[model samples]
Target: MPLLRNALTCSLLALVSHIATAAEAPAPVQSLRPLLTTLNERLNIGDLVALTKWDSGKPIQDSPREAQVIASARTLAGEHKLDPEDVAQLIAAQMEANKLVQYGLLAQWQAAGHAPDTPRPDLAKQIRPQLDELQNRLLRQYADVAPYRRDPNCPVWLAKARQGLTHDALHDLALTRATGELCIRAAGV
Candidate 1:
């Protein structure tokens, strides 16, 4: 009876430890808010300064339409009798640019292949979901602070791109541009 009791105690202890370990494990990082926030802030400062310099007297609603942004800023300055608000437009444009870049990359990736446009049933099934999740996070982060820059279609493009990148491809992109110079030098080209 004593031996049986000891065995039962050991089994319970083992079970408890297993459960504790499982419960205590840390979760993965899913959001890119921190990353996007930094970029958004930098873009904002640049735009606002430029806009303020072109001071047009009109309200923000009367934004100028010009081929170039600076030209638009100048036009806005002339129309509104005040400079464009650089910080405000900068934030808006940065967000827009990021979404555009993400979407373009995603479209390029999707066109490359990997089970076109289907969501994964399970997180562990493939890294594509993780990539989608990261893109979503970055987009969400951009939206939270700079809502005006939001683009719904950006995710679609991001999802496609994320799925397309294999580890080797990632490594190559990271190194290729820098290495291209070396290759040219070695070849005397």
Candidate 2:
């Protein structure tokens, strides 16, 4: 009886160990934080953009500029073996979230007679070029993590990943919504 009990205990321990290993190995979402950090950095450009647009009286939604960005993103995605259409959708989500921040701030500034708390950034020189560079970095980060797009738990993991980065309540909600949309594209959920 004692020998049989020892054998059973060993077998149960081995089974539990195997199960834990498998569970730990396949969680693809574990690698998503760096990618999410890149995204958080990208979205943060929106505040400076809003300030610039506020100073210049530029509208938040520039369809032509947006289209140009979309085209460029698709080309970049192709270079990284990411699906162009999916990449476009992802970029659109980011852009729309960016615009939401921009428009909201711009509206608030307008209401306050253009005296925004955020200092105006140079749109033509400093801001635009910085945004272009950040776009490239963001695209590269997306490519690195693109393989895990099929993970069913992507949305949940992504939400968890951005917890620290999403500082502003409104902007954080917009970022979450945008990322949720991207996850939907990835998993068709």
Candidate 3:
């Protein structure tokens, strides 16, 4: 009975230690969550952009603006010590995702014959400034999580972090598109 009790106590201690170790294990996914959150915020802005376009009859595809954004991202990437091309790709993915949301929402509104009755901010004055601010925040966040981009579990972390951010399929798709460039697997892997 004494020997059996000692064995059980040892097993319990080992189990507790294992659990603690696992709990303390680094969570790269959690570390990347702030960047995901900022990205989601950027995506959500697409709804407002859609509304502005719907009201003003402005087209969704703004080539010059997209180019400017990519340029800004490239410049900011240098400041953040991130690769310029990689940052450009990331920003481009984000723009594509935003356009996806805008296109989807515009289509729905067009089919319904009217857009949602919401206050529309001026795209040039208000919206662009807001986006610029978000761009800076996003670049900073991207810098912080840049190291985790090459982690093997990056996709898993991204998917898990993205959960519950959007309920609808369109936004979900946009989120997926936005995060497309986040994880980069090494060559031959």
Candidate 4:
């Protein structure tokens, strides 16, 4: 009987210790939420971009624009004290995600024979500025969570942090693309 009680006490103490450790563990999900939010916002703008392209009969793949954006991101990364290559990758992921959304929406509209009758914002005059502002916010938030990029659970945290931010399957996929560069596995891990 004494042995049974001693074993039970040990088990209970072990469980309590595990619970405490889990409770104190760093929450990478929370830290990454702001960056995800900004990315989602950027993804949402893909709708506007799609609408503009649909009406103008413009192609979605704009190489010059992509190059410009990447250059700007690298410059901004320097200001943020982050790796320029990494930031460029992140920004490129965002653009790819945005393009995914644009492609999806354009396809839908093409099949329907008409685009949605929504107010169209000027891509250069209005939308670009909004995106530029988001870029700044995204870099700031990225700086905050940059340390967590090496966390083993970053992908898990990113998956959790993305919940409820997307409106449809396309956006979900876009979000997935946007976060592709967010977490890098550590060396030999």
Candidate 3 or 1, higher lDDT: 3
Cα lDDT listed for each candidate: 0.36, 0.76, 0.91, 0.93
lDDT of 4 by residue, 42-133 (tens): 99999999999998999999999999999999999988899999898889999999999999999898899999999999999999999999
Task: Please identify model 1 stretches exceeding 4 Å from their true place.
Answer: 1-37, 40-84, 115-189
lDDT of predicted model 3: 0.91
Q: What does candidate 3's lDDT look like per residue over 1-189, in tens digits?
A: 999999999999999999999798657777778888888899999999999999889899999999999999999998899899988998999999999999999999989999999999999999999899999999998888887888888888889989988869999999999999899898998
TM-score of each: 0.20, 0.77, 0.85, 0.85
lDDT, candidate 1, equals 0.36
What TM-score would you give candidate 2 relative to the actual structure? 0.77
TM value for model 1: 0.20
- Which is the better candidate, 1 or 2, if ranked by TM-score? 2
Q: Candidate 1: how many backbone clashes?
A: 18
List model 1 lDDT by residue over 1-189, tens digit each. 999999999999999999998677521112222533344333223233223222322222223421243343334443333324533353345434433333334445447753234332332244324333443343334333332223343343323323323234422232222111111121332
Q: Give the residue spans of candidate 2 off by over 4 A.
A: 1-30, 111-114, 184-189
RMSD of 4: 5.8
RMSD of every candidate to native, in Å, equals 19.8, 5.1, 6.1, 5.8
Model 4 misplacement above 4 A: 1-26, 187-189
Angstrom error at residue 30, model 2: 4.4
